[model samples]
Target: MPEFKQFLLADTAEGLTEAEILSVRVQPGDEVTVNQVVCEVETAKAAVELPIPWAGKVTEILVEPGQTVEVGAPILTVDVDPAGGASVNGSAPAAEEEMKPLVGYGSKTVTTKRRARREVTPEAPVTKGGYVPLAKPPVRKLAKELGVDLRALATSVDGVITREDVQRAAAPAAPTAPAAAPVSSGARERRVPIKGVRKATAQAMVSSAFTAPHVTEFLTVDVTPMMELREKLKKHPSFAGVKLTPLAFAAKAVCLAVKRTPDVNASWDEAAGEIVYKDYVHLGIAAATPRGLVVPKIRDADAMSLAELAAALEQLTTTAREGKTPPADMLGGTITITNVGVFGVDTGTPIINPGESAILAFGAIKDMPWVVDGQLAVRKVLQLALSFDHRLVDGQQGSQFLADVGAILADPAMAITY
Candidate 1:
């Protein structure tokens, strides 16, 4: 007979006092292996899938889905054997319980009061230190979104933790008390509950805003030719059902512009005291969804054809809006582009996405007076704003990238020249 091993949910990061078990993919008596995704736990940032630390037989699932549990809490129990063979007496090593692998935050055996009133009756809810667990407002908000009940949690006896508990709190919530209802209504701002990826984005944005010195530059370009080319392309048989807009051209121009200017395709590495330039392009498209603003990058956008890029963009936007974007797809971008023009706006000083060097904002393309053939003529024009890290890219390099993009939009024929 082989000695048993028990697996646990190890702490992934700090400041995570409690977690909401979003889903349990594995059940008791199920055979599991190392690196197998057993469950997904929702922290304040995003829901992360936790892999089984070591291989074993899942003896019991200690937690339920949608249950809020503190960090270091027991999530599951697994039975394991040393070398897959012997009992503790023979080939198995000494029972060093604390030396268990992935038995999360280390294991502790506790003796609980056995049920005596169990003549076919439900047992009382478990409480910690003779008091029900209590969480603060923000924690409560997170638990609510994760479908957790604070009253069902187990906390220390002294319920000293209140709404004013500052440490370990990250979620931002605007109070919706009845007295403040009038002001909220007057602003007409929809109070979207912050959770999931949106909450993570909020934290990143705040950190970036305060950490980085954001500088934005704006330019106006005549994109009449680009718009015309889009119309012409749509008439082609292959482009049927594909909405060809100036954005597709803009994205292509950005890719070309990046080749000319590598610094724009770089990131500021503060700790390393260097600017890291990427050889490839992970172009991000900033899309506005009902959930929030999500920038789903089309990996290796430089290699994709016009048709492929358009299709990719369409799919990315659709998935983002439906909140079906996978965690892997949301990261690793070199640069970003936002189409503010769709909302009928004309240019804005957009903020750079965190970790990336630059972000381009495309304004509405409208008919305006322009100098075509050195004469004042009415032509379709668009404004472009390039926001870059000054530390990484100087004005000269930034201006050149913007100019290249503008030139492409000014005359789609220039795309052939390049």
Candidate 2:
């Protein structure tokens, strides 16, 4: 008789409660070796591939994709040899030393392999042009933005509708903008489920907004000197192979400014009825990805050089935008910066991340008339907005912190004073 071994879903990292089953890679009776990836899951963090620790034949797949299951729950069951000799399909049992630890090693060596994707079928036919066309999430979002009805081109395409089709469909009139989603005649609304990163972000924002008394301050600065210095640094041999960005300069500035106004780097300890202050800075850069907005931190950012900061920022944001930022990377942020300027916006109030007292919003850089030595002339100007927890940081402290950041950006030399 074959003995059965139930494979339980383990917590991939700290504070993991549960995860959504993203996909199952094996079917019942499929032979698997030790450490063979069996499924993929999406936690509040990132997508993780789970590998079976035991070599056996997959007896049952207990859960389906998109279902949320708690940690320690059985995700699948495998049949093993009763005597623990040869395993599934007569393969020798894996050596004990070669097996990955089951508890927290859920994602280690979890290779990325493309599983044949399931066909996406439209759910309803109540739209203006009939049932929605078959397309991936990104393609759908693109079509909606371009105003090209999916149903209109559904018949023209053989299978899934590509982004090119939508762009081509909308080229006649709104050539620049692809138009989709004819909502005039059909259902007035659709709902997106709040889960994963989106769900976690909603909860955090609400909690932070309600618990922290937020105070935001704004400043405008001429960044011509900073921009000029940046160009000079780009040509320097030491800065080569580094991706220098304005955000990096802002990060370096924030670190320098924190030395003077440490209150912005502190967090409120409500449970302890005291304030927690730190000498070191774990600077978080707010990133926008397909999943949602995530702020991953640069550990000990205060100690890094400008070049190091720039390289770290490049790696951090790229990982985030790819939706591969690990759960551990997203935790323990001391302060955050959101570069809204990349989207060409002037400035807006930003919310502070949880556990941190302050968040900075860096706005677009533009040429504006400025008074230089009492003469109005065109200069590169940038806007800054700083939001802080009023309960922890007083108005004066917040303003000073914002001023310190702006001063460094306006004149990089000002950082030396801080």
Candidate 3:
């Protein structure tokens, strides 16, 4: 007789209430091993893979893809003793007195309760007047919008209908109109659900903007020397295989500037009624991802060499773009930098990220006419804007920090003197 066991979705981190199932890897009757990835789920912070605890043949999957499930909900069931063939005698093996723990089981103690099974009939089509098909609410809405009858469409999986099924049914109707037809004629407005990383970012921005009093200061500097230095570093052996951008130099400048103005590297603790100053710098780089804007931190960025900082930035952006950044990496940031230059835009007043006192915006560098040594010449000019929390940082400190950053860019050699 085969023994059956159930697996629940454990909370991956504290304060995580739920996660949406992105993909299901295993199905009924498929054998799996312990610690094998069973599915992928997306929380508010990031997407994570869930593994099964017991090695067995899958008996049933309770949750479908695109469905949001709460923590501690049963996701699937498996038969631990598949070779016993318990179905031949129409009887299941007796429940074990003690069960092994799974990866997602957490530290909580497990309790078992048995209940009699009840038989369920298959859902009938709308014409037969039995019941509607098993489709999620969002999928049902999409099917209605596309004029697709859920019961009339064929599904690859048993017992459930999916969004893909509706899309396939609707694809045949698209060619009725001309390919060049305007989309606005069909649907004037499209709505997207705000959740996951986007939702968290929105809430954080709102909180930060309202709670903190922001003061922005802008500075324009000639960065011709900085650009020339980058060209020289390209030929250096230590910079081989590293893509050195102006952001790397700006990051180093900020790290050094913080030492002169340590208040910028502190956070205001509202609950404790205190301002916390950090000794080590956990620098944050704001990267725009397909999902949304995410700030992943570089641990001890102040101590890293130029080459090391470039490498860390490369890995951080790659992980963020792939939506694989973990929640732990997104916390405990001391300062941040947003490179608006990548979008070819000038500086703007950026809101401080929650828990951080200051943020710097690096603007696009352009070649323009400037007076150098009382003579007109074309030089690389760039703009920098610094936004700080008025509660912790004053005008004098903010201006000095921005000035130091500008001086470093104006002359890369000033980094050594400062």
Candidate 4:
């Protein structure tokens, strides 16, 4: 008698929650082993490669790419045996099922037929006359960027074309004037439909901004010493190829400040009748991805060095830009920092991400006139804004915490004393 084991789904670093299948890597009859790469999944955070735990021949892929799947749902099936050879045709060996963990370990045998899916109308329809009219999501987004029209593509489908079809069609017609205006907007204004990260962010921001009484405080600091230290460190062989920004130093400063001011590292629990101050810091870095703004937290960021923090920030930004950040990395954040300086913008009074008590916004660094040692001179200066909930923190405490962070960034050497 042959035995079987099902490899249940574990957390994919950047997979979706409702299980949308993006792509499948293996097929039936393929022999696989434990820890072998099974598939690549696209989640809210980043694209993650999933590993198969049990070794066996591939039986069937239950889901297809582009379809979302729920957690704990059966993703794949495999056969296991005492002799190391299991077949799907063999009877259910009771011994194997008995050994399976009851909860959260492996896949459970769900007895239900798959549901039929509804038909989806393509945005661009393939019409007769040799014109294939259709656009994928990326193409649609590109068209919005380039100001192309799906209706125009449909009316003038010259050949079997895709999103690449629409792009090629609009590329040569560049009149260099007003032809690139968005079709969705007025002749002067354009409107792009909200979807993906932008859509999710809009919904979340609306909920947070409307629900919370947001209060933001700003502080302009002379970070000349910090900037000088960063320039010196950039020349070091260890800091090669890393994009060293003042924001990195700012992140470290925030972490150090949180160590002394634990109240700022907390969440509001309305149901529990308490403001929970966390002993551990899950430092959230707000990243602006193509999808929208996402806050992926670095677990125990307080324990990492400046180099480690730089690497983590690099990983987070890259994963975020690629739309592969894991859902787990987005959770459990007590405080957040958003660097709007990348866009060359000054400080913004940002709204706090719900559940987190405070969020700091870092603005662009620019040369400005300042008084140094009672003399007016040009120096590199930057602004920092801290938005917090007055319900959890008072103005005095918030001011002091912001001051401490500014003091650290103003003199990177002070971090050693603090």
Give the CA lDDT, 0 to 100, for residue 293 in model 2.
87
TM-score for each candidate, following the candidate numbering: 0.63, 0.75, 0.76, 0.67
User: Cα miss at 27, model 1 (Å)?
Assistant: 8.1
The sequence of per-residue lDDT tens digits that candidate 2 reaches over residues 191-249 is 67778888778867866887789989999999999999999999999899998988889
Candidate 1 residue 298 Cα shift, in angstroms, is 1.5
Q: Quick one: best lDDT, which candidate? A: 3
- The Cα local distance difference test for each model comes to 0.71, 0.81, 0.82, 0.71
**Whose TM-score is greatest here?**
3
RMSD to the true structure for each prediction, in A, is 12.0, 14.7, 12.2, 13.5
lDDT of 3 by residue, 354-395 (tens): 889999999999998999999999999999999999999999
- For residues 161-221, write the lDDT of model 4, one tens digit per residue: 2445565756776456656655565588876644445645664576567655677899999
lDDT of 3 at 69: 82
Error of 3 at 103 (Å): 3.6
Q: Sorted by TM-score, highest first, which candidate order results?
A: 3, 2, 4, 1
**Superposed model 3: Cα runs more than 4 Å off:** 1-3, 81-186
